[model samples]
Target: MRIFVLFVLALSFFGCSTKVPCNCKCPKCPKDESKVFVYNEPEITVYKEPQQLSKAQVYYKKQVSYVRKKAAPYWGEKAQVADKFNYVKYAKDFKARTIINFQNGVIRVETTDTANPLRTLKEVIASTLLNTQNPETVDLFSSRHTIHVGEPFLFNRVKDHDGEPIRWVWRANRYAQHLIDTGLKKDAIKTSTGVKKRYYVTFKMKQDNYSNSSELNYASIVKKQAKRFGLEPALIFALIETESHFNQFATSAIPAYGLMQVVPHSAGRDAWEFLTQRPGQPTRNYLFDARNNIEMGSAYVHILFNRYLSDVKNPENRELCVIAAYNTGSGNVLRSFHKNKDIAVSKINRLSPDALYKHLRQKLPYKETRDYIKKVTSAKKHYL
Candidate 1:
């Protein structure tokens, strides 16, 4: 009874959905032919084919950068100084480009050397921080320079609009860094002439105009774009809502941008190329733009349905694959079918769409991916 009441509320909220033709069933394309989903699709404008790199290149670059970031000092970085470094004797010269440990406190001597020279006792300690496996040592070293303020300076407390005393708060959220799938990267990375894998220092987003209901034209835009690519508008809306709640300027912990949470370094690259007919590359400016974000995001779904999940025939099952592929990559979605390399199309065909859905629910290794699938499916009904 509760489920029925909720269904009624959802239908009233999003209105009735028009059934659209979907190509999700598991089947191989006929020999000497292509399975073109539509006949009258608009021609994609190719301003220029963007430059892209080999998957191996993208993977190597990402791994190197991750190694560098692990070595660098960032506030969020955590570490407990291993035994020897924590108790190292002070060298004779404290001013050299090495950290000097004394009975009183510690001081870091800065250097501009590009290459890591673990010559000093400090560098030995730094090596631990540089290793991706170790947690950050920022907390270990934060109190090294223990500066005791002799005097306390007091200021008048500030009040808020509600006549309450205001307090300041800060938070930290660890992002998934340098994906561990070496096997996936070499195949997943799609590079081109103008499209380069994007890198970001921070993933922060400011939403000054987010609350203005009048400012959103996302639904209409999503409807138009989805129809152009033969997708249900409600599904797109559900994805956007679940991804960023339709926030035009939303960003994720992975630093994925806009409503789709498209990560420029990965799937975002593929989606961009598909839409503009250009080499997929990273763009800080365009990624936040509402139109481009949705277009690329929708384009990704098209690729997944047509390419990765092509064998998945049922519309409902296809949608499930599309949703999972959006969150965890299409390759990972495929792997969920059978962890072994010998995943046959026949095996996929034998299972009902419901069986495939359950298989995904149970098989995906990541809790995040599993939760994402459920949320997107549940919210889809709301938009429908």
Candidate 2:
């Protein structure tokens, strides 16, 4: 019994000992796994490691950093710091404010209000970029920039004879602004100085060869001539339209010259000859001279008005008769009036200038004459 008791005591002591070795051991924990460990006499917890940045993100960050550094001088210190930390945010905000996007190899901007901050920024960027001697290529995202090369710019102003001012406002493209700044603004006028003077005899000629001729000029000229001859200005304008298409130097293949398409037979040779006969000159110049053209044309219209006044009492009818005579010759127009005299005056009166032109076109012998009447009548309405 004593030997068995001693053996049991030995077995219990061996089983309780921490130094004893075992055949199986537990698997080690992964580094990523959350585990508690002792460090510097304090308990610490371990977590999974963070991932490194991607290649694309790294490239973007580097690009943003470079741009920020380059823009520092222009944007000042605060912007530079913001760009360094949050370039995408800064760029997006700037774009929104300026209505301009300066990313993706182009700069785009828009402004409904001229005073827009973004518009100002765009101007600054454009000025700065263009002023550089070796500036990088820039693409503006607006249609205004499309006119920068070889496109014409138009400017127009109208004023009444009574000193009333009329304002004409036009939005200019970038090209137009550049042209104005570079002294190319005068190049866009379509009318010559001499032609414009004849059209607007009373109005002061401010600029030479400025392309525009206003309707007011035509109206005023017509008014002055019509008042002198006791005729309607509308009729005068209509004739002028048919004769010259409002061109001062308009000449016809049939030896007619000027805005009135005057022949050399009655006016004499040379522009000066018609007004003041020079010695040794037998005939007036065949070419259309602006002043001579208007004067001769107006005189012819006045004569026709007087000749047809007895049959055509109304100023409108007299004018139409004059235009018909100008197109079909006085003999043919007189014959047509005699043949159609029995027709109701109201029926003839209802005929519009266009209708009369169409009727005259059918009766006219020459195709050119017929077309001439139509063109003149059409132009008359346009100018009026």
Candidate 3:
């Protein structure tokens, strides 16, 4: 970098005829010619807005921060343990948390309130151990969990790994001192370090991208479904605009069919059964029928609002999670809040919606899901 700067300085000096005399008598250096070189500096890139974070990025960061703190006392500059495993090695192991969860079924985060049970992860977790870094290499359980949320449990040496538990990481003991220092006790230990935050109205879900023009296609049916589902017509329109822009036959790489693009096998099947109480029904392709698509999509979103997001008390918080889950599955969305895979919604239901949103914000596993949440939620404002 210094060499490049020096080269630039040399060029500038030579370019400035008045600053220094041209000593070289070669034809390249013309004494009579007034050499004036205008230095048009390269454009500095500026990012206009903060982007919604992906699940991997969030968890990786959280895991790294956590590992750094816990591994510090052991792997500091002056320690014998640092010889065999440097801070780097220990840190990498902590990152293996996500992998740990899958290999050893997702552990419950335990303390006075949570559980720290150790069980072997499902087969799905180990199946993709060989190829997680490759984006093209899709893990079977990739659909069930984003690899970034990391493993559910921290480094539990006594149980899963053959090591001693980091004393500072003990929730029961650390939290007692933390309460004495702070004066008030916390409800549950934070998944990681730092003061727990409570975000209310101020927090917005991934901001939606506003479309210049709104859709008028199937306007009547959209309003009818929205009304039946007790949703704002604009909210439905926001999803429609984001999903297929009222394209009744729109399909996706996920084979999401029709206007609302409900995945045939998952939400679509459930929504279809919910809208129609019968067994025999075409799922994947027939969702192309505009009315069926709208009913199913709207019903699914409504179900999300009332069921999946029921733990979220605030209307807006519930709305944001619903919008995100519509793109990413609800299980994936819920799992993001706790490091443990089995955190029940009822446990944190009373907590403000913003807490969950912020906790799970950057923590959403998939980049597509994170961006989708932002765009749909941002678009929701315009609809409102």
Candidate 4:
């Protein structure tokens, strides 16, 4: 018994004295008695510092100057240059710096302001060119200048109302003429004219007083359809702008047709069949019908909105997600959602739209998307 007890004690001592392996893997001990286990630190990845824009500012300035020279309209002696950079004037007084950069044969404008700088620049350039006697040359120069400088033009409107509730009829006519000469169509103006006189207008030699009359006429239809599907007029407008630029008969390179740019396959077999079943329409001619195209487009947008609603909490964010999904597939939007889940919901929601349009010349990805949001929002704010 004593011997057995002694053996048990010996076993306990041996168990207590023996070294146990750690939960983590340990380095192999050396053969020498003096050796001790040591752990190496984890390997870390080092990223190179990002290049600073200040270092390249001088080069950018020189390049801009060269472009401005090239954009000047040449007479026999010297090219005429506009004395004042309209955007620069606004920038000097405003909170943001509007930079127009022209690189790689693309015209891009960037600004820190909340306003849509690209659209503002487009309006500026269009107005300036329209005012010039030689519109073709001005358009060429403006396009080249925009591509070179990567700058956006500032938009400014002067008010002529003389503190009266009703303004003079001649004054209203003059204002209308100014708007027309500067390429600001009636649809673009927001101020109410007290005059009731009608005026004639022409675009590309086609006479039309109201360019967006059809869009306005379809507003009732859009509002009803949008309300039914829990959609916004702005979303409809954005899709319309992207798809057909408001042209009912516009066809894309992919052969998508009508105002909403609906391709048959994208609409699904069921949607295609339903769209083709409309009375008094040829079976193959469905794509040419504006009402059919808009219906399909709105339905598709609604479908996307519903799909993303599960992942996105905010209604506004869900709409943006739908917009992104409309541009990039739903799969891409989902992937982006996973990758940028921690980012602000607003930023994540705009990812696919930004990515798909990142390379567009007049439309800088984020800038254009933001502008689009603002424009649509503004239109809704005023009209809806």
Question: In order, what lDDT does every prediction score?
Answer: 0.43, 0.35, 0.42, 0.35
Angstrom error of the Cα, residue 313, model 2: value is 3.8
For candidate 1, lDDT tens digit of each residue in 99-136? 32211223232322223322332332222112121112
Candidate 1: how many backbone clashes? 26
TM-score to native of every candidate shown: 0.46, 0.36, 0.42, 0.36
User: Could you give the C-alpha RMSD of every candidate to the true structure, in order shown?
Assistant: 19.1, 43.7, 28.2, 24.9
Q: Compose the digit string of candidate 4's lDDT tens values, residues 50-90.
A: 12122233333454454344422211112222221111111
Q: Global lDDT for candidate 3?
A: 0.42
* Candidate numbers sorted by lDDT from highest down: 1, 3, 4, 2
Best by lDDT: 1
What count of clashes does model 4 give?
13
| lDDT, candidate 2, 154-256, per-residue tens | 1122122333222222222242233224421111111212111100001222132221243343456667766755655666666665454344433332334
| Pick by TM-score: 1 or 3, better one | 1
lDDT head-to-head 1 vs 3, winner? 1
**TM-score top scorer:** 1
